[model samples]
Target: MTRRPIFNRRRFLGTAALGGAALASPAYLRRAYAQSGGEVNIWTYNNFVPEDFQKQFQDETGIKVNVRLVDDQGKQFNLLAAEQPNPTVDIMTVAGHRFLQFVDSDLLAPLDTDRLTNWGNINPTFSESDWATVRGNKWGAPILSGMEVLSYNTDYVSAEEAQTWDTLFSEQYSGQTAYIIQDMMSIVMLMMGYDGNMVEYLDDPDTAARIVEEAKQFLIEKKPLVRKYYDSGAEVQQMFVNQDIVLGHSWNGPAAALITDGFPLGMAIPQEGSYGFVYTFNIANNAPNMDNAYTFIDAVLASPEIGAAMTRASGFISTYKDASQHLNDLERKATSFPDEQLANLQFFRAEANELKYGLVDPAVEAIKAA
Candidate 1:
């Protein structure tokens, strides 16, 4: 098997496509079940687990894992919700922003911290977010985090010019800057915060709304400068690679790939900070293999090999505290855990009803039209 770089444009797909596929790495397929002698099923998206993660976990715990990849969280959540009486999946990973809706609907089971030996091993800062907790009970554990950063093509923009967000809207780069069309709230959050405290906007709906409006207006003002709006990380990477764009607001995975490939690319959190979207693992209320589920979670968290592999391949910072020791300098810099980002990490959370009722979609459409 050719070892692919951890994450690349070729692998980035839309959320809808990401959520429904069954992708098993060779290591996973060859491993035998150790303890339960039963199968454990996990449903998650791209980068949630390194390609080799399932294999490493099975080798350590003797648990056979069956992984199904889904592209869209909303679709996957609905599918799991429909399967509530008897879920086909034992554990599902959902984005942090959407976890409350799952909890309010009772689609997820409250995590039994007592059953998780590694529960204490997780840094409380990442695992203890109100967004990951429901009804004052912990329902999820952060597994991976991705942030929006300014990524630019060095072949085009000067190093100094690319260091700020202005590179994305500057006239010199007209029709050569790109941003994700779907990240309205994140874009707004970034514009509103100076160097962190992006989380504060989550507490003030009025402030968030005002920020959104300002950001929308900003985008509309720059519409002439945008080459094209993109919908997935892969798409942005493609545009950058093709030289259709000089700068963009993009995620770490794509930026890492470009840098590793020797593209004249640079990424920074910028002085104003960035927005983060985290994905977390949650148990289902109707989990058929609860013991296997807990074992699976613990096994993955316990495997330094798996954690290191994830960092190397996926560009996602593993949530387990112990995983840090296995990481190299680059890996350490990638996650928000210990140093540079510890003070700035922001999680997405809100009540289920609030999210369901929020008409942010229309607001985004209004921005595009305006």
Candidate 2:
């Protein structure tokens, strides 16, 4: 959280229902999508929507908000692909790194930004990136932005040893370390002193493939040091609860949640830098309720009123430029980071093709089996 808290950098602001359009404004977007009170089906991660937003949206627009919760990004991607012939959901939540696969497969619709008056409220880092836009058309509306970090039981590991990732492989912590598969692919590259996006090498297939292969072999060799290749945040937290892991690589949200609830834990952005992710809204291909999709996205972008509430529920920060204005000092600290560290925050890159991404799962699986 801000590399460390800077109490004076931000102040607490009361969340008194400023409910307006995006930019946390005193305005509203057109409500044409509410005609006949249609439904907008959304497939999203758990705890992503603020309760009040859901209640207020239905009350004000008469449109029914149907949410289908999804637990994993990979599974969500496959479900979308399988249903492509007759897509069921109107809008889906996706991570920046994974958006490309959806777009490449023709599973998403180009965003109708012209109708989204609040599209300008997005942070440039998200709105301008190649990941969020393609062929000069915006395809995703970024909602949450966060990065992964190395976390440890503060009572067992000193901050000094936790400053870098080498401790994760040290014999002293052997059989006490864990990491998510997808994350380690990029973070391990970071540990190798790669300050740029590792996937960017896909631009030169020869180099990218070689790099991936090397990383795969490296992970296989280190497999014995890892206690588990965790699949979810809850699983990692359970490891902490059972005293099964002394060190782990995890998303910032879960670790922050653990710390807030009085767990003896500490999360740090390692000195080698780390990868970041942004959760966003993408319209499904052939969505039946296209109008409703656009309207719902505007409401989400306009939801800085519950910025702090979202952080409490989901553990990630909003991408709205004025989000800091809504956060109290503590929330602000956990969401923002220092310039030096932020400079090295790399996001997963779009693969050269689906086959490129296809190689990733098996490589990770091979390490898991070994």
User: Which of the numbered candidates is closest to the native, going by highest TM-score?
Assistant: 2
Our tally of clashes for model 1 stands at 11
The C-alpha lDDT values of all candidates are 0.64, 0.73
Candidate 1: regions farther than 4 A off: 1-33, 58-64, 78-87, 129-132, 189-214, 330-357, 365-370
Model 1: lDDT of residue 232: 61
TM-score of each: 0.74, 0.83
Tell me the lDDT of model 2 at 103: 80
How does model 2 fare in lDDT?
0.73
Candidate 1 has its poorest 10 consecutive residues by lDDT at 15-24
Tens digits of per-residue lDDT for model 2 on 1-370? Answer: 1132321211111121121112223223234234447889999876577656676677668779999988678888899899986899999998877777788789999888988877888788878877777777788888887888888988789888887878887889999999997678877766775423544555676776677677789888888888988877767866876678979998887675555444667877778878788888889999989998888888777645555556655668777787668655655665566686677576666655354556667787788777
| lDDT for each residue of candidate 1 in 83-192, tens digit (9 for 90 to 100) | 87888998898777776677777888888878776676666767786566666788876776677777876666666775567667778878888887556345544655
Error of 2 at 234 (Å): 3.2
lDDT of 1: 0.64
Pairs that clash in candidate 2: none
